[model samples]
Target: MRIGYWWRLAATALLGLASMSQASETAEAGNLVYTSGSQGSALHLGTRLDINVQGLQAQVRVAQRFQNTSSEWVNAAYVYPLAEDSAVSGLKMLVGERVIVGEIKEKAEARKTFEAAKASGKKATLVEQQRPNLFRQEVANIAPGEIIEVHLVYSQQVIYDAGEFRLRLPTTLTPRYIPGVSRAELLGSASVHTGASGWSLPTDQVEDAHLITPAQHHNTPGRLLNPMSLNLALNAGMPLAKVNSATHKLAIEKPAGAAQGVRSIQFAAGEVSMDRDIELSWLPEPQAAPVAAQFVSQWQGERYAQLMLMPPRELAEHQVLPRELILIVDTSGSMAGNSIEQARASSLLALNQLTERDRFNVIFFSSSTHTVFEQAVAATPANLASARQAIERMRADGGTEMHSALSRAFDHDSSGEHLQQIVFVTDGSVGNESALLTLIHRCLGDARLFTVAIGSAPNRFFMRRAAEFGRGSFTEIATADQVQERMAGLLSKLQKPVVANVQIDWPQPVEAFPRTVPDLYWGEPILVTAKLPPWPSRSDARVVITGESAGKPWQRELVLSAGEAPLADVGVPVLAQRFGREKIAFLEDEAYRAGNSEQARDTVLPVALQYQLMSRFTSLVAVDKTPSRPAQVTAKDGAIANAMPAGSGMQAVGYPQTANGLLWHLLMGALALVGLLVLNSRGVVYVRTEFTAAAGRS
Candidate 1:
């Protein structure tokens, strides 16, 4: 081919490539995919959160309202996140005046039932757990202008540490990075993958990435955007000095007269955009701070109790251990904006916390891992300066290759003299969480792994479990401003001794979980749930918990008879459901460690069904027998995109777009132009003879 011909072809291809770049950039904000004829579906979205905090347990009711205003019959789906340890207990589907209660069944069975109901034109809703924190709710057979509301209720333990009790309410999730090879179809042109509900297909590492990785879209006129409100009624059972939220402004008021209690709390604004996780923390009066607590409930005439034991901060006070701290920060594409800034600030703050006796290193990971130093080094001023510079120079881009990053940190040939603690700072956006958790379970020897979750909405499930498996703590830094304060708290705990090798003794025969206890730090406590024999036969039940704090054995004994310290007596099934949830977590962890999730699915099924809770092995499904749609009309699927986490600068979820209209159309157009250019370069199409010049290529 003539040089001029090649030059002309090169220029055409470059223009096409630029257009593709812009389209792909738009995809980051989200590519909401709706079935044909449903693009104009008017979606009205709102979520109501009703939370009640009693003692150490919180029960949350989530009511998601999705109204379809389009002329066509439609089915809708929404993907969202919950607290990692939430014990989901109830699901109800409401339409107009009737209600259909959800029942827990094996995941496959639930799917079959939902499909059958959908095929028969009946109204149905299926809720399944995609991950510990991620969930998917699908509703079928909605008539035109019909309103559907799926209400979910779950129970989670309130975290108490260092004089504050904390609870997390997750509204959205960060766009996770799915690591591994994309399916051949996914790698094809955008046309081949268009209209898929999720941005990602099933990858080799994450077989169900599509389920968890929902697409995001802005609150455009034709798209569904979720905006939610949160209302909490807190009866702490005691006096609280203050109550506040780090993510949302609070509006607190005493419920009607008799007014001395901290009563009901709400958001200052009526409704806020659902983009970030809310961290609600409350400070109790010093004298009201609990040292031990126990809540009991009755289910099927059996007693279930939740236990909490704080092993005294004084023990961790006098003990300090020489350490080997390895800072692993993620510089992935999802962390490109405020997320990266927080990670950077956190890394620097941690470096400042190292003592003379501690040895430290820094590692950054995106598509690949980059170590600041080959191995752990003394925390001298010079070495610290070098680490800080490397961190400051880091930029966020590429995929989140977490597996390689973690493996590199826990290399077999690392130091064994000092106590090694791995501090992983990231947005926690990876999809292959079980694989990473399994790796940590096997590789984490004596070293502790502390995960600092960055960004507005991180993967709480992975962050919590990774820390649990590595015998450490999980800290969340949502913004750049939070980095200094949160990192300081985490680092201070890192320098102190953790209460390890914990064992609990119960007064009577009972079924309880977590089978094993992880370490406790600072004022952190030990929480356990148990199913006891029918009550009234035992002596005043005294629960004893023992552990080692600072190389010294420590013990705490609490009377479960219910006097002053811990509130007792309950009517709800939250504790019982929590026991089942914990049991399932234990079994799943064991299965993950053994590398056989499918083989162990059976072990978690019974627990899930028994407690009426949702799990990986089981799901909650509600079906209304009456058909809601006409037989002649087909139910078109509606695309309800997940809201991207706040501060994720990608322009789709509530941001202005540089590119507009159909993405696949633009892609195909660009591809066609490139094809024409290629044909012209080969002389298939007529081109001027003088157009080919070697100098033109340059």
Candidate 2:
């Protein structure tokens, strides 16, 4: 009897399981679609950035405004991008004429505080780090037809590359790919948050996938929801020869001098759609770049110094040792347009740099990985021709399986005869950065991995970190026009190391930002920031640096003058912030390698708290305290969607949130239950037939 009852129960369960498909589909589809149709309207967002330049540093103030056009209270969340190494220092919430300053707190505690404020009818704001370059901001209890403004400030050192000073700002983001074993928990939490977009869902691999993946407007013919205006004050501290925007149209207001002085620049148009990255480049007068510059400051009885030392560039010599070059390309759907084109061009250029003695292979990956050969082959004419044909015929489709592709790149064990160079060509559109870096570090045995960023707005944080772990270099090719120049430059650096075995010695004990430095490339500088004790005398303190160039020992010494004029009042804080950030990064790396979350937290918390900075495990929060809204009316919250990156594919790629191993087992059990029912029915009919036949015979 129990068995029969179980069979009946099983049949009922199977029907329920079959019916769940629709619900799962609906939930996974996001908030844009319902049984009725598309959503009514979207939350509007606007941004303004004001920048001030002082020598090598830039201080920026960003104002983000949110407006609710609907007839109900709405809570909004926004995720945006910033420079990879930015030092976020301040945040304020502006409501009416009052301002609420944000304070740094532990990440979990900040979330709980925000949630509590949200529950009680109070206006609150919270900012948390999603990635090194990505952040999420939450604003609660915005009444109907309300306008809320959020202001933030951060400091970052400008980029100096190839005799030019450059500053880049990312205005849009390409959706990232997450690869890991799926969990059943993601599907059940889809509806737990309001104001979510229709494009993504939370997943096990990327817990905040829904937060990072914003709604994209494809071919919409209206004013973009997120339009940004940038104003920059350029103070290069030297005579400027030229200034121009590499990626956008800009209106330059030059100063009243000849090729010198500060310049004011703004968008040529009033504001621009957030579709591409903004890059501004300026060149100093010929042969006028500083080879070494130092800034010193004193605060709270401690002396701080930040300096840059550009090693003299070495002439390129003939290649003596052969190399093995492994090229890994991302052919996922996200690379369907201009990104693929750039990657193809980059691959072709890399092929041209290979010599007859070198060996090479190509690995292309999306949902699955494909290789041109089982192992690397010599750079022969026939092999090159075959590779070109295969690469050109490839098309973009399917999800991004980045981990598998990376594994394929590292599959071949080196015999220690030749140097192995893995050139990864991608947009760096993957969210699981920690996992990827961990994997790379584990498999990166004496192999240098250079990342070729292939799109306008690649993930800067991921690309830079990957290069750091692989002990290589990173370069970006934003457009096809710049491919030749950039790739040629990269090839020039591959002949030999500019400097190696770099070591710095201080006259006394001092704390420096990086305990160790990477090998230097041609024309690259060694920049270090340190905190030191008060020197005995101006002439007595000195620093000695040692390195090797072209198998010859090289050394330089710099004397520290404690009585020298201070650089700026702000320099001390800037130096301290940079040092703190590096320390946190080191601790996080150690934690990742050992898989010890507790250790990471314990080590990083004190430093973060002392510096009052935002980090992966720490956040910035602000509360109004006064209950602006009644407790009875809870605010409705949702995530605001970001604009679709220009030239990126419209097709989406990721694993199904509802599909997992446990679910598949239950489905199989249901199928077995149905089979048993059919068998029992057949048995009953056969018995009845036999009994009837016997009765007739009697």
Candidate 3:
């Protein structure tokens, strides 16, 4: 199947621009007016832009105000507000005139085109996109003089190295519709201001710098300018700054030879707060280890599924141990931003971990693919250095082509003497998980695969699944700060093979078994638990397990005695299998959400309810709905003894209270309304409005 075609469809749906089978129109009630405003908290040095710092949360308030601008009575549904062109700058790195890095496009059309182009061996181009990490959308209705309020809370990662930060927020009010007037008028003069410290400059300074010029005196003028670049020579030590203009935000530049320090920049447009934070630290000296290995694993049951680590180890007996390694990195357009900085750091760390005994190669794919050291190379110092240099010089410029990368990684040629392994590191933003999974199933080999996830919200699903399919492990680096340590831990796992072709069996038919056994790595102990039939009631059950050690296969057996009971007992293995199944189902639900298929979304509900499960996008809340009834009347006393009679027990109803539910409801309503409008326009259904008054003496 062509993956690109599906990608485009998904992308367009996400952007709310796709011409689906549904149509919608704006409906207003009363003289309702909605207004929103945003504020920024911090600033960055290199660029005079607001950045969300690691430990700081930014606040944004969206308020809906209702006013009787018209002399009519009416009631209406809630008004949903969406922010247009809500773009944050300064935190992004620009190439030439374009914001080359750090822009996320939610446009379905552009995404479709991009995915299509990728499949056709062409570059996926982005027409327009927004910052995916920071933005807001809200909907609500109000009666005359009634106001509803909402707050958008979020945090941003500091991407630059600097000591100061700043933010400026400017707001405006617009009406959905006017009864008499063709257009809405400005409610009042709007102003910008700062709330607290950690920033310098007052509200007036920003207004003065951003106000309209007297020479061009134009009414209803909006003046927001995207500055080409900032000049950062003058401001050195200030840790915060802001520029609040309805038309333009502050432009900051980095000066040569500036001292390193933490900085934050903020921009506020009415009720929206956009920030960019910079964390500056002195670059540390390069360090290398002769050989090292590390392992990390969470407990599954009484035993463990080991994630093995070994820089180097001697082979035991006649075991056939072969080595394989694959390196996959994202060179997509988004990665063109500070992502390159982190990628280079991680690549270099991986190279340092290789030893002379191992064989490995590097694969860099974006719109295309490139390999270093020509095929797989020996882990000699000369080859390692060359590989390191090649990765450091790598640049980000292309759309993601994940399928091709995986296919090539699994097809790498390996000698039979060493164990095979693949290390995949990426931001994981592609929309073709199914296709990748199919390829993984086809390419299953003795080789294990490890995944290193990069970026703020990298695709955890892909990382975890890829590792599981390849029989390896997965790790993540949330920021550039954690790249080194995370990479080091992953590399250390390749030293030795812990267990090979391990299997377990019981003398009598076992009641329960683990769906799959965890692969044992070097330096890790083996632990397995199984359930036997009720003890004492049945003969002592014996269990047997076997696996290859060195060149010979080994076996072990155990007998358990238990008394038979009237009630069934839960075994460790049974519980482990149940947990594994639940986890797998959760991952599938996540994939469905990301795919955005109506069928998939619908299917998740039943499974979720069956599991009594709550995922990242779902929650189950219980509500009591007991009706209150009037007290019973006694004929003799003609007085009430009790206020109310006992009613049916409180009923519990399951209600979905997540963003997904809200989206589903909105989509359904829009579809129904579109259908009604179509019929009315076609003369199939007649629609009319009439006003009637009750008879009264005037």
Task: Return the lDDT, model 3, position 697.
Answer: 4
Clashes of 1: 2
Please give, for residues 527-635, the per-residue lDDT of candidate 2 as tens digits: 7878778776644677888898777887777776553433555433766676677777777777666644347888888888877778888899999988887767755
Q: Quick one: best lDDT, which candidate?
A: 1
> Candidate 1 residues 1-698, lDDT tens each?
23343343344344434533332232223222243424445364688999998878899999988777667777776688999998986889999999999988889999999989998999999988999888998888888778888899999878876678888878888877765543423332432223324544445677775566555654444443476888898878777788888788888877776334356888888777787898888888888888887787666767778888776666444467688998899987778778888888888889888878889988898777889889999999999999999988998777688988999999835565688999999878878888898899889877889999998888888998898888899888876777777787798778865677888887767788877777778767788888777546657687889888778888999876432222354323777788888898888899889977766687888888787788998889999978877788887653466676777754442111222222332343355456666886888964433211110000
lDDT values for all models: 0.74, 0.70, 0.36
Best by TM-score: 1
* Residue-level lDDT tens digits of model 3 in 1-698: 12222233233233332322221111111111111111110101011222232211122222222222222211111211111111211112121233222222223433454434333332112222111221212111111232222222112111111111222121211100000110101111111110000001111111111111000001112422111122112222223333122223433333355433223232223212111111222221123111221111222212212111221233453343335566777665435455567778887787776667678788898666788856788888888887787787787655466777888887787678767778787766443454565567567576778778665334455566667667777666655667876576566555545455767665555433233655645433333323333334455445555666554565555454332222233222222333332343444534543543234434544433332322222321111122111123110000000000011011110001011111222243345446555766888743432111010000
Distance from true location, Cα of 504 in model 1, Å: 1.8
**Number of the candidate with higher lDDT, 1 or 2:** 1
- Model 1 lDDT at residue 262: 55
C-alpha RMSD of each candidate structure in angstroms = 7.7, 9.7, 23.1
Q: Backbone collision count in every prediction?
A: 2, 4, 76
Worst 10 residues of 1 by lDDT: 689-698
Overlapping backbone residue pairs in candidate 2 total 4
TM-score: which is higher, 1 or 3?
A: 1
TM-score of each model, in listed order? 0.86, 0.85, 0.42
